[model samples]
Target: MFEYLTAGESHGPRLTAVIKSLPSGLEIEVDKINKELARRQHGYGRGQRMEIESDQVLINSGLRNKKTLASPLSMTIENRDWKNWKKIMEPLQLETEPQKLTNPRPGHADLAGALKYNQKDLRNILERASARETAARTAVGAIAKQFLAEFGIVVASHVIQIGNLKSESWSQLKQSANFDLDSKVEFENYFAQLDQSPLRCANSEQTKAMQKLIDSWQAKGDSVGGVFEIIVRGLPVGLGSHVHWDLKLESKLAAQLMAIQAIKGLEIGAGFEGASQPGSLVHDQIYYQPKTGFYRGSNQAGGIEGGISNGQNLLIKLAMKPIPTLAQALASVDMISKKAVSAAKERSDACAVPAASIVGEAVTAIVLAQLMTAKFGGDSLSEIKRNYQAYLKQLSEF
Candidate 1:
């Protein structure tokens, strides 16, 4: 039910997002959405764009008195830098023809998108392809996050690797600390503190090393990418179905997480590593207790088994490639001149792994919200909560 669409350009007047459906009576705070937007802009290696744009959501419709009305929610984030580009990016007629871009950047949509759309100017392809549109998705996800929180569901993420430097993953941290994986507050506190870190990494030594790596790469006119982990707590079992391929929870999460720009790889729990181990060692063994109901000693399955949630904290990891735009442009052939030329260099980050982690959290929240609404159908928040409580009772009795 939390389906949404986003539209905007990197340097356009504004970005827009429309959430098609949501339960009525869900309270939404504009400041919370703005907070998430600000979180997206934080992190080292960000470009001038972050400085130029202080993103905040402007609600257009589908809300009354800060509560949902079960209608479409429309929002916009004004691009403050649009003032400088108005002449070139004007929607209608212009007094003079704007300079057309012919060079396509490596590892970007410029070439393929232009070929598919039959456009000579690469800007036509790059504007929408830019990751700037994720700001709108972040705004939409902020609302979904609030809705999830009402049901005790929470989502968070932290960067684990940047360039050659690596830090502890969620599972690794739990094991090292002999942590209680079931403690929701501990999980929240741990990831919450990461927001203060420049790289959003837990290890101070690794964070410093990663920062140095980014600086080294930037000085060399290169870019770097890394990995992050996402954690979701307080999810109920059976939100997804085992009967359908598309209905599988991991499939849904993988599809959305991989769609984030620059994301090149994904792993759920012991993903690739588990494949190399024996089944006896890799599989999570089952256990039961009167207080906790069905449980597992390990989470190698990432909280989902047989395409349905297993009531454990959901774990996901994503790998982002180096940002395509670089200070030292790569060799490319100009589309118009049909001659070798340097790739286009846009204002970009030297490393964006920390920022991408926030986007990962937002996307994960959106997917879980969609599945939650699908599993417990209702038109209002109270109705959904009742259904959710009933489901918990059923699980307890089983």
Candidate 2:
């Protein structure tokens, strides 16, 4: 239903994206997409690139007068660092002024990627391999998030933990949150909200605690990880297919989540916790009523069961490991010397758990939008709206 590709290196001239098959006549908002790129650069532990780059979307194709033309949409987000790296990342041969990387971090794609590709310069591998690629993904996902908004569908995410001090669970916080779309409130429009507390939390008390915890651990020259949950509401059921392994909605979504940097694990409902419980206790009990279409006693399945959504909130939780680039660095062998060396350390974040959540939301939005279009395929916005309305009617009457 939806597919995207990204190009450019970690410190390349620009991060380029091409998103194909978005419905025609859908309004394109430059600010909305730029804001998403801005969000991706946020959180507690970001490096120097964030300082230099002021990401803005330059619409190259698939748009006319602020509307889609039913063609492959292309956008380029300029990397501010590109000016300095013009010679370094030039597509043409650079006379091999070797910027060779010898050390490979344990948790990164350094050594294995180079070995697999048979490349001497690890920069060749690490460029495409860097978390910097997420900029392209996040840019495209912002468009996906906009598409989701076309329906009453809403997707929101929040940080639950930073390191050992876990933040509050998503469902609970969402229940207590008060945001009026009419009023238009948004966080993460800035560069540094990572210290905004325990959950990278916007809440005052929690944000303060998270900041303290980060400061406490900063001295050890180590980084911390955190948990975040994404909730998709107003999604009609049956967006995924059980017919094919590749077509399964959960698998596609899980694969996207795992694609992020330092993201070690993902869970739908009970996730790992459900593994310890019996079937009777772990499975969500479905109940139908006049008020709600098909409600569940508990969402242990994380909104999808048997590879298809069951009309419940699509809840997905992810656990991110600390970033591999740390000041103290982990022990690793230098590829050139074949001797032990400390992991490469550039300017890195102290904690990126919060920023990771933003990426999680972005990635999930793209997946959900893809699934939505898969089930309700249409070329134009008007046609998609008609199909979506019919689907909603079917849902309501049932």
Candidate 3:
């Protein structure tokens, strides 16, 4: 369930998303969806496009009286900037020749996309390739988040690194704190405070330094990129299967998270760092209690063991490369002219790690929602809840 697809382009009339499958009788809040869209635009180093567009989701089908109807849910987010580019972006033939972009940006899809589709204009390739498409995704993920909330599952993220500066990771922060990491209230409160921060980072001093780094680079006509972590809490022990490679939770997570624009790398828990540690140090030790059932003392495996969720908080880290568009563009050869030229410059952020963290939360929610639906397997929210409760009861008895 929760199968979906997004359509439309940056600067187009509107971005459209169709969620082809979802359970019935789930209540959805439009305001919450809009709130997520607003969060995606609030980061400190966002470009002028954030100012020009205030995104809102418009429901087109499969919903009535705020409840899902068990059909394909469709939504749209209008691009406020569409008015300015209507002439050049008309779907039908244009009355006059539209300007074509020949030079491709070095780190972007411009060159390869054009060559793949055999297009003369780079705009054709870039329109859909732009990260603007993530708005529709954020909307879909908002609904997925709502679904997860029904089961008491929460997904959140925070920026940990920007350029060369770094902040404590989730594991390190938990170790330094005196509170219980398993307490849902404590965990939620921590991330709630991060929502108020400009960089979505818990460390105030590091956030200020990160902002200074962004400012210095922007002044130099350069862009910056960094890393963020996604943390999921309240997952059951068996959402995925070990029988098939594709069914592994990590594989699903890596495939989806890596699909986000500008993302370059991914890590789960200790990940690459665990390579240098001995087996005894890197592996999480198992323990059993009558009240809590089976558990782990640490989560070096990132909440999954043998391709299934281990009822531990899921931890994932991702790396994003600098935005391809720059004030001083990189050198490139014009496809049509066959001469040296600077890459195309577009309105862009000096750094977007903060905004990307919000995106990470939304995306993580979507993947968990998918797995939950698969595990519970019901046509209605109430039915899924019944199945989930039964599973918990079974686990307790075991």
Candidate 4:
């Protein structure tokens, strides 16, 4: 099984992640991981902090000569802003007084976390709750992506909706075509086109409109959020089992997506829309060919049925609520004064759907990597490949 844990405050000297149980002998590419960290920082309407920080991952342990030693992997990304916050965030006692945050931001973890931990200063809660932690997760996911790539699995994401603006390409695909209408080759072309977009969106018109909304909201001291879709391709059938509820693929994917800050909703394939339709319209039709084996004509179930992969492109969409930290703060009560006050204001993005889309891809990759490892057990990449190839051969025979 694959698992990871992260440690660090938002303004701490560095963020750290420890990932374990990765198969041995898998090549590690520092540049590829750094590129993912860079992607996590890209997006329109990002805060000034993005400009101050150039995130680069340092692999402190687990690899020897750029290859995994089958041991725990440890990584870190230095927080450049730490220089300015050293006194405030320093671990040891300081001569200077610590900045105390009394007013909690609405829609953030500040108040809830502070109350739960019996903290007087909200900074104690907000530091770890900040989205900055996603940088460490992105680095971990980059490893999962590399591992999955060894088996031909690829993950990608694009913003489908931003506030009131929705991608026309997504609308077209949902309304005009069967879920399986596009071949893998065709989808790759679409992904290539979206990758060129500033917001990682497919439609230029919608993206422009979203950018305008972001600008308007920023000027108003507000923030906005929207939806992004994640797609995973080249997965073999039966990665997840229907035998146990916790082992279900959809369940695992949902938990991971919801863990990201501001994400409020998740959909798999035609999800909520399918709920309103009849079984005839919602269920994918099955088909089989001599060479292709079993397949689906549509994928309204999102390449998963009965909690198992059905050998089609996995589709998922995430909905993110507007970030809580606003320049024009919302109403709240001061923890110390016990009086009505405005919410705390902090440096934050007006919109982060584009960047969240990348994080979504990363998390999804990690889940799929876990499922793949579980299904094809091995302590080394070569052993896993051998096992997976045998499973493929068995499937072909079946």
Candidate 5:
């Protein structure tokens, strides 16, 4: 199975990611991965960490001479602030008194995590639970995206809402999705454009509007959240299996989306909207032609049905909650003193919807690539190339 593991505290020496089961001979680029990290930090309402960290990945294992080794791939993203926090985050028993976190932030993993582990200092929970971990995840996801792009797929995301302001439609976004996916040059260009944009949105008007909404949130001295969407094209059929819950593509995709910081909800095409529809209208109607192997009239099922890809576009939506380091902290009991108090204060963004969209893109890429590797079944790029070419030939001939 395609898999990944992450380690390191939010304020520790560095973030680490180990990805396993990538096909060998697939080109792995450090610069490309770092670019994704840069994208994650570029949004309008980012916190001070963005200013402090310029994330760059250090590949340690599972790659040599720019290609996968088909083993576990390990990476490191050094925490620039680790030096200053070394004594505080030390794994060794502290010779001095550990900084105690009495107050816990509302809507965060702080208090619950500490209580579950039976810890007094909420800092033990909040340190590792911090959203900073998303930086490492984005690095790993970027590699997965590179794999998907090699197969003629295009995936990009954008912010659609901020606080109370929401956009109705981003019609211009539909124009940039053309794909002859699965190539070096195309993948480079595809991400290049996204890296250049402020909103990571294809539509200039929509991006400008998003910027204005962010400005409004910044003025409030409060935090907010918004809706974002990941749009993809050119995915083939049968990337996931319906036979098991763990194998369900949508379920796996949903889990990855929800795993990101501040993301509270996930939806696939016409997701919740299907609840109101009768079964007849909810599923896509099948069509076939001599030239076209199989097709769907509409994609309400989000390119997946029966837990597998059905040859249509994938549309995933992510709903991010407001950043939790609220300018006005919520009430909580102190872990050390056992007295009620305001939550610990931390520098945070007014909103992170746009940055979260970048995260969504990374995770979706990882899941999709994992499925593709599983279905195609190869440990090296040469084997994968032969199998993929044969499959494409079959599709074209059929």
Candidate 6:
């Protein structure tokens, strides 16, 4: 099995992660991980923190000569902003008092976390609850992406809706369209087009309009949020088991997607839309080919059925709510004084949907990687590939 845990405050000295149970003999590069980290910081509405922090991962363990050692992999990313908060965030007690947060933002974790942890200052909660932690997750997912790439699986994501502006292409995809989806080359071309966009959007005009909307919100001291779609291509059948509810791939994917900060909702394929459709329209029909084995006429089920992958492209959509921290703080109460006040104003982004899409891809990659490890059951990459090839042969013969 593969699992990872992250630690550190938003403005702490560094964010650290420990990823365990990776097979040995898999090559990894620091630049690849750093590239994903850089992507997490990109977007039009990012805060000053993005400008201050240049996130780069430092691999401390579980790798030798750019290859895994079949052990726990440890990594860290320094917080460049730590210098400004050193006196305040010092490990030991400082001679002078540091700034404390008494007012809690309406939609943030400040109030709830402070109360749960029995903390007097909301800073204790905000430090760890911040979305800054996703940077560490992006690094871990980058490794998962590299691992999956060896098996010819590709995971990618792109913005679909930014507030009221929607991508016409994505809308068309939501509806049943007769297209040449059986060709992997065709889907690769589509992914390539999305890759070229700064917002990870397939439509250039919508992206431009989305940028304008973000600029407008910034001027208003407000924020906006939207939805993004994640795509996983070239997955082999039967990565997840249907025997147990906990092992269901859809459940696992939903759990990870919801865990991301600011994400309010998610759907798989024609998820909510399928609720209104008839049985024939909602379900994907199966067909068999002499060369390709099994296939689906439509992917309304999103490449998953009975908790296992069905060898079709997996599609998932996530909805992120507008960021809670406003330039002009929301109405709030001062916990210390017990009086009404404007909520604490901290530097914040007007919209993070684009960056959140990258994070969605990262989390999805991790889940797929874990499924690969569990199914292949190998101590090394070569062994995994050997097992995988044998399984493919068995499928072909079946």
Worst 10 residues of 2 by lDDT: 182-191
What lDDT does each candidate get? 0.91, 0.78, 0.92, 0.89, 0.79, 0.88
CA shift at 139, candidate 1, in angstroms? 0.6
TM-scores, all candidates, are: 0.98, 0.90, 0.99, 0.96, 0.89, 0.96
lDDT of 5 by residue, 276-363 (tens): 9998988888888877677776678878888887777787878888888876677877777778888888778877777888888888
Over 4 Å off in model 1, which ranges? 178-181
Regions more than 4 Å wrong, model 6? 169-186, 193-196
- Per-residue CA lDDT of model 4 for 1-398, tens digit only, reads 56999999999999999997689999989999998998888889899999999999999899999999989999999998887999899978876998799999989998899899999999899999999999998999999999999998989888988888887434357566554435667767777777668889877887889999999999999999999999888989998889999898899998888999888999988889889999998899988899878877678888899989888889998999998899989999999899999999888988999889989999999999998989899999999999999999999999
TM-score preference between candidates 2 and 6, better one = 6
Instruction: Return whichever of 4 and 6 wins on lDDT.
Output: 4
Return the clash pairs for model 5, or none: 102-334, 150-182, 151-182, 152-181, 152-182
Model 2 TM-score on a 0 to 1 scale: 0.90
| Per-residue lDDT of candidate 2, residues 212-270 (tens digit) | 77777777887777788777766778878889998888899989999888888888877
TM-score, candidate 5, is: 0.89
Sorted on lDDT, best first, the list reads 3, 1, 4, 6, 5, 2
Q: Tell me the spans in candidate 3 whose CA falls farther than 4 Å from its real position.
A: none
Indicate the worst ten consecutive residues by lDDT in candidate 3.
288-297
Clashing pairs in 6: none
Q: Which lDDT value does model 5 have at 104? A: 86
| Error at 225, model 4, angstroms | 0.8
RMSD (Cα, Å) of candidate 5?
A: 3.3
Q: Backbone clash tally for model 6?
A: 0
